[model samples]
Target: MFRRTFWFTSGVAAGVWATTKVNRKLKQLTPESLAAAAANKAVEAGHRLKDRAVGFALDVRANMAQREAELEDALGLHADPELPPARRHAAIENRNKPKSYVIDRTTHTHNRNEDH
Candidate 1:
């Protein structure tokens, strides 16, 4: 009789525990809880993406610097770390100047006449 009572009590306790666990899981699976979990996952993914982008940018910059150094070495050109502002402005202006080419007008005219 004692054994039967103990087993019944044990079974009741196990059933209650299982019901509580299932209820808790069902609550977590509710719409609001699921939405919150999805939002958290999205935020985590965004953070990971941002970190990867920053790392990629740093790698690209390093590679560009290395390539520039190699090019300078191959061309026997030394990089000037600092230059006067006026000189820098002048260099930029010169680089922006349009090139002028002198074409032979007579040859062009003859070619046009022949084409016609």
Candidate 2:
């Protein structure tokens, strides 16, 4: 019984040591690994921004389509099936605006959802 116990205890000790050595090596992230991690984060951010922009564009398109349909109904003219509704609204807005306006490029503030 004593001999069996000794062998078991020694086996457990060896296993524990081997596991610690492997874990220590794995914990060391090389410079390449760090760079890859940063690249992945940047790619993820780019994808998220693209998705948000697409969603915003879709929403604007839907609103403009609704408005254009209303305008067509009011004018008693058939809506040009070839013209995209969003472009029509954009054209109207552009025509109504002042020709020149200065952009205030001042200190920018971020909302809770925006990155600093």
* Best-matching candidate per TM-score: 1
True-vs-predicted CA distance for residue 37, candidate 1, Å = 0.5
lDDT of each: 0.86, 0.82
lDDT of 2: 0.82
In terms of lDDT, which candidate is strongest?
Answer: 1
Steric clash pairs (candidate 2): none
- Model 1 alpha-carbon drift over 4 Å, by segment: 80-116
**Candidate 1 on 1-116: residue-level lDDT in tens?**
99999999999999999999999999999999999999999999999999999999999999998998899899988856695433323334455545555566777565545654
Task: List residue ranges in candidate 2 displaced over 4 A.
Answer: 1-28, 79-116
TM-scores for all candidates: the values are: 0.66, 0.49
Point out the worst 10-residue segment of candidate 1 by lDDT. 84-93
**Candidate 2 per-residue lDDT over residues 7-45, each given as its tens digit:** 999999999999999987776476777788899999999
